[model samples]
Every structure is written in C-alpha cells, then in structure tokens.
Target: RGGPTACEFSFVLETLGSKIAAHEGEYADSDCYEILSELALLGRYELRALKLELRLAIEGVRADKFELPYRIASERTGCGFLILPVTREFHDRAFNALQSLSLASKHELELERQVGIGMWKNSEFVDVEWIFLEGGNPPDPDLEGRLAFSYPFRRVSEQRLPPIFT
Candidate 1:
C-alpha cells in the first residue's frame, strides 16, 4: 500500500511522458531527450517531497523591472541537487520570427524595444541563468500605448517571454 508517495510518482511519470510527446522536431520523435529532461527535473523534487531532503527552485522572469507577479515557475519533484536549465535556444529562427512583428520605435533598424526574458536554475547552492532578448527596449516597462515589439518570441514550450512572461 504505497499511499500518496507512490501516487505522486505515477502522476509525475505520466506527465513526463506527455510532455515528452509534446516536444517538436527530431529530438522528440527520435532522440526522446525531452522525456529524459522531464525525469531529471521531476527527480529533483521527488527526493525533496518524499525523502525530506534538500531541494532547489527554478524560476523564469521578465526583467522589465516593474511588473512582478508575472514570473514563470519551473519545478522538479525529486533528488533536488541537479538543476537543469532548459530554455528556447534563440539561434536564428527566433530572430527571423521577431523581425516579422510590428515595430514601435524610432530606431528603424530595431524591432520593438528590447525586452529580456530570463531563467534562473537554483539548487541548494548552485544557480545558472539563461537570457533571451527580443525587441531592444519599450520606452518603459510602465506605459500604456506600447508593445515591446520583439516580445511574443513565437512561444517556445518552456519559455517565458518578456513584457508578458508566464
């Protein structure tokens, strides 16, 4: 009779499987790397919840410097030490997509303004950060008639875009 602990493991594995299947490209269909990633994350938290061991926190936030409540939370459920920092690798495809969006600034060479999205992977003692930049600036993080042109970075599954991170 493995109560809630076992049930939690079952649920986590199920979610891990689904999330794996959700990843697009050769990585999902052939490599299956996403599932392995999920397991690594879940295993971190599971150790904390079940074994009452040390743990860490994974956070994604928009560095707009004003709005606060819109941060993104990435979590794991076991082991707790290995903090995997996963994010959308904005190589070339990301920039081309941002270029198609409407711009709202004087710098004709730029998209919107600059909006920066970031992820922080923190464990009991370690922290790794990743940043994704779009647009360039929005005049300000506290204004109405404006959009940080480069925002809405095509929506990567585990991404939290700036000016509207989640």
Candidate 2:
C-alpha cells in the first residue's frame, strides 16, 4: 500500500507540473534557473516533505551576524520558498503566488534565510534563493516583519494558479 506517500507524490507532481507549465518562459532566465532546476528535481523524486534553503543576500546582513532557527517545524506541508523586498514589481507578484501554492501543498515545507560569508552589496536589498535541503542544513529561526515569513498557500490548486509566463 502506497498510502499517504502515494497521495503526497501525486499532489507534488501535479503542483510542479502545473506551475512549470504555466511559467515556461521563466526557465530562459538565469536568475530563475536554479529555481526551475530544483522544481524539476522534486518532480522526478516525487518528494512529499522537503526543506527549502533561502540564500538571502541581505544588502548588509553579515554571514557571521546572520542567524537561523534551531529547528524546523511548520504547521503546513509541501515545498515552497519565497523571497522578500522584491525590487521588481512583476517578480513580486510571482513570488507571492508561489508562496501561496507551496503553503497549501499539505507537506512540511519551510523557508530559511542564508547569507554569504564576508559578502557585501551596495544597497539595502536582498536576493533570495530557494533550494531543497533535505539532508543538508536545517532551517533557521523565522524572520519577523515584512522582510521574511513562510508563505501562506491554502487555496493552491489547478484552478487557482499562479501567474506563469509562456
């Protein structure tokens, strides 16, 4: 009996397929390349629960100074990662939609912020990278305020889909 694992696998595959199909145009860009790669991996493995690594390039947060949670235990499930303070208006909506879908996956998916060691940037901006860290480092403490938070994706499905460029 495949049990819940089978159901979870089907759900994950459907979610990934719909999202990728809806946003086929995004794969052409290098920035979203990694995101696309990871999505492809999840679909291949049919993973139900996964940890998302956020390589958050805070405009100033030092690698040493940056902090993460001691553990990862979210009330929701599924793998969905979202970044914050998006400079582009278009990407802002895209990230928001992704967060919503991920939250609704009914799997244990969480987002963690990461920083580069001794890396520096010009302005008060952040670059986010969403990765699957199943056997890698665990998630850090959740960030407060508008800067970061696990996305809430309750009504994610084929009908209520995120905006994907073709």
Candidate 3:
C-alpha cells in the first residue's frame, strides 16, 4: 500500500541529468520532454527551464565525447566470421566482461566470438579493416586472409591493449 518515495524522485532526477548531459537531444523526441516539463512545475528541484539549459549545454559538447574506441566486435566477411574492433560509448560493461573472458586461455575463442556478436548486434560503428585475433601466430590465409587480420593485444605488436589513458 505504498506510493512513490523520495528516493524514487531522486532517482528520476539523476537519470534525467545523465540523459541530459550525456547526449542532448538524444531524448528530445522521447518522454524526457514531458517528464522534464512536469518536473519543472514542481519548482523544488530548480527545474525552471532546466531541460532547455541542459540541451544548450549538451549542444556545446561534441558527440565524439561520448564515443569509446576499439570495442571488441565481430563481422561476417567472405572469409567467414572474423573478430574485429568497433567504436561506441554504450555496452562498455559488456565489452569489459567479455574481454576478461578472452584473457583466459580456456575461454579466449568462445568469449571473443561472443564479444564480436555483441558488436555485430549493435552494428553502429563496426570496423573490418583490421581484424584482431588473440595469438602470436596468425590464422590460415584461407581462414582469415593474409592482409585482413592482425595479431593485436600483444606487447610487441603496434596495436595496444586498452584502458588507453586519456
């Protein structure tokens, strides 16, 4: 027999703020407009024109600020399924989770394949130019084509494992 609590209100505010700051008009056509409008009426949260101000502030921030590089992903080439890299801001936790699995010898291929599928599903910024497989020896040309694949995530290779400091 309970109604919405103070915590719920605070949660909504935090979520709205994140949505506002992370990407301005990302929610412009969504319910955020209505929620922000209603919340502005409360006058308790300093909501007076908050959404407009937020949109203006977010406009100053470029979209690239929200992008992350070298996300673990995969693709289906003429050669077959090849693990690769992609760039995006979301699904970071999923990428990190699968990357951890890829580090373990027992789970490398299986987990890498899963990460590739996850990227493939997103399909927003998938890259197939340079495929990254986890090993010193490259796969067969018939399996992965000589120029297509690269052995990344190694100490010697030009490619670097990330958590690349900003």
Candidate 4:
C-alpha cells in the first residue's frame, strides 16, 4: 500500500529544526525549494504514521543505546510492537539474511546491456548511471555468489567447458 510518491520530509525537518532553519539566507536556494516542494507533496497522514513509528523505535534504541540488539519487527500497536531483536549468537544468521537481501536488489549493466547484477538494500528497480558504477567496486568474481548476467543472454554454445584434449 504505497502512493506513487513517498518521502521522509519530516525526518529532514525534524533534524533541521524549524522550517525557517531550512530557509535562512543562502540556505534558501533551489535545493531548499525542491525540499519544500517535496515536503508539500507529502500526505500528512503518512508522515504522521512514519514519524510515530520512527519515534518509538528511536526511543527504544535510545533507552538501550546502540548496543540495542537488531530487530525483527512484528505487529505494531498504538503503543508499540513486538520485535525479535537479534542476539550475539544468532548475529551470523541475521547477517546472512541481510546479505542475501542486499545481493538480491542490485544489478549491473554495461552499454545498455547487463554485465553484472547488483544487490542493493531496497526492493526497487532504479536506473543507474554508468559513471556511478565505474567509480568503485572490485572486479566481479567468476564464480557463483551474487548472480551476474551479461546482456542479450548468450547461447550456451558460446562458452566452452574445456578443450577436448584436456
């Protein structure tokens, strides 16, 4: 259940303090206008819901500090929700789940053709720029892990298993 657009405008606002704090002198530039326009477009209901949830989670974390265990969230009530926070022993299991999810979201393409796959944190199909991809990352390994598929899906015959003599 999502609108065509979503924003965490209030998150920015909360961190920024008053609205005027965002619009003071040189700060009130085109970027600020864009932010304000974005904020204006938000559904107040959605903002309230997200803010409430974030505040509770933030409060809980603040109470426990950063050492607060990682969580698997369950149903939420007006007061709070059930969360299965990760323990040190099960941290590896949680890590595996997160790593797998990250790997699932990313992709890599070259020359309008895919050269690799990307695993990102978000479940979204985003258009990425070539320059951005080129800037970082070590070479993709030639083994199974995060799957990589180059463009046009080459025929099986294109790759040789090994030389016949070998």
Candidate 5:
C-alpha cells in the first residue's frame, strides 16, 4: 500500500479530540484538568488547521515526494484503536506547544509526565512509539520503520598514517 493519506491523519486527530472531550470531566479536581479541557477545545480548531495544511502540503505532490518519520499500523489494536507510530520530536513538540499556552510550569510538567506515561507507550524502535487511542479505522501501514532506522546509515572510515611506520 501507499503512505497514509491526509484524510486518515485528520480522522485520527478527530478521534483523539473526541476521546479527550469525553474525559474532560473525569479529573475535575486535578490541577491540570483545566488545561486538559482547554486542550480539547483548542484541538478542534487546530485539527482543522492541520488538515488544511496537510492538504496543501500534499497537493499536486507525488506519493514518494516526502517520507514520513514513522509508520501507521495496518491493523487496529481491537476495534476502535488506531496505532500510530510517531517520532519523539513530534510528541515533544505537541506537549511543548501545550505548555506555551499559558500553562504553569508545575502543571505543565505534571501533565506531561502523566499523559506521556499514561497515554503513550514506547515501541521497539528508537525515537518512535505507537499511539493506541480509541476511535478511527486502521490505516494502511507505512512501508517504513522508525525514523532512526528508516534509512541506511554509513560509518566513517578512519584514515591511517602508513608512512610513519616505514
């Protein structure tokens, strides 16, 4: 199959937004509860903008024009789970963005630690992991591995001074 389409990406984001919305009231007493609620609201607007950006980015471009840093699993975890492998950078950027949205440092740190450990899991590949969240259909797996091992790496050769021994 081919890489994940923009529609699939949008669907995944929407599913995540829905799950976040559903849990908005679960931890009302937590310090980061407000931030979680705010994120759910902001996610809707951001997801739309992201879809537009993705559409523009892929417009008139060939399938192989750009490579994704991680893969999408072809099968769902059960029925409503979509497993998405994403780079650590992507994960960090998302949380960092949330932090920049007027969240207190303590709250931000707590939220990151909680969500990172609770929601996300580490995969076998380096700098990549699967996001197994509820909702959305399974997308076709990308034909690559994690970013660190996606491409071949060349080792540098050491130069020797042969004349000095003679």
Candidate 6:
C-alpha cells in the first residue's frame, strides 16, 4: 500500500524496456536489454515466484550494478525544479560506470549531456524532465522550459560535495 501496486509495477516493467530502447537506442545491443527483460519476467510470476526470480536476476547482475548520482542531486534539495549541478568528477564516474556496464561507448558519452530529473512527492516520481547541461551549467529551467514546476537553485560547495557512488 505504501508503494506501487503489483499491477502498476508490472506495467512499468513491461514498458520500461521498450522506452529505454527507444530513447537510448545505443544500449539496445548491450546487456541492458537482458537486464531489463529479467525485470520484465517478474511480471509473469506470482509473489512467491517473483521473489525467487528477482533474487536470481540480482545475483546474475550483481557484478554489473552501479549506483546513479540521484542521491547526490537530491540531498538538501527541496521539492521544485532543481538546477542540479553535476561536477566534472561526477561526470567522469558516471561515464566509467556506464562503460563498465557496456551501456555507453566513448564517443556516445558527449561533452554535453541531457540528464533526466525525477520530481518525487509522497514517495512517487510525479514528474520527469530532461535538462541539458553544458560546461557544468544547466539551462534556465524556467525560461527555456514549458513545465509547470518551480525553479529553485540549490548551490553546494565543490569541497563539500562527496565523491559519487563511493
């Protein structure tokens, strides 16, 4: 009751693979599809079967699992359209992580990247937007954006920033 229902989870699992494949077509040939398909397989199983299946899949992909920098972006930042600043250090780590997972090639990791930000409320990601960052500065989410979200810039010192996925 606190999280997504089984039906909702099933729908997300069913659609997530196709959505990722369509948006990030380069990852289509990688182990990403197999990982996603493993997740999708959970939808076909009952609760008891789902647990066993998920455990097996987790074991299979344990070596490849990498953390996203969402926690770094979220901490101390309140609810709003955040101008999340991604440091060069974070960027490099992210690239290496993706490379390890075979999800990105050197050429595919551009100098400028469009980061997908999810807005969470009441334990759910209510809205998502792709914001482009160039030279570590994100475009004005309010001016160049059409979303109804508010903009609040939370500035953190580089020295205070923790090493990502450590």
User: What digit string (tens of lDDT, one per residue) describes model 1 on residues 23-67?
Assistant: 653354432343244335443334333222111112221121211
lDDT of 5 by residue, 18-81 (tens): 6566668874334334324433433333434434433433331222132221111111111111
The lowest-lDDT stretch of 10 consecutive residues in candidate 1 is: 61-70
Candidate 1 global lDDT? 0.29
RMSD of 3: 18.4
In model 3, what is the error at residue 92, expressed in angstroms?
20
lDDT per residue for candidate 2 within 115-135, as digits (tens), equals: 111112224433332323322
lDDT to native, each model: 0.29, 0.32, 0.31, 0.29, 0.29, 0.29
Per-residue lDDT of candidate 3, residues 39-110 (tens digit):
443332232222232332222222323312222221121111212222344345545533442333113233
Q: Model 3 lDDT vs. the true structure?
A: 0.31
TM-score for all predictions? 0.22, 0.25, 0.19, 0.28, 0.23, 0.23
Model 4 misplaced regions, further than 4 Å: 1-14, 17-23, 27-32, 64-166
Query: Any runs in candidate 1 off by more than 4 Å, and if so which?
Result: 22-166
- Model 4 lDDT at residue 135: 24
**Candidate 6 versus the native: TM-score?**
0.23
What RMSD does each model have against the real structure?
16.5, 16.0, 18.4, 18.6, 19.6, 16.6
Number of the top candidate by lDDT? Answer: 2
State the local distance difference test value for candidate 4: 0.29
lDDT minimum window of 10 residues, candidate 2: 113-122
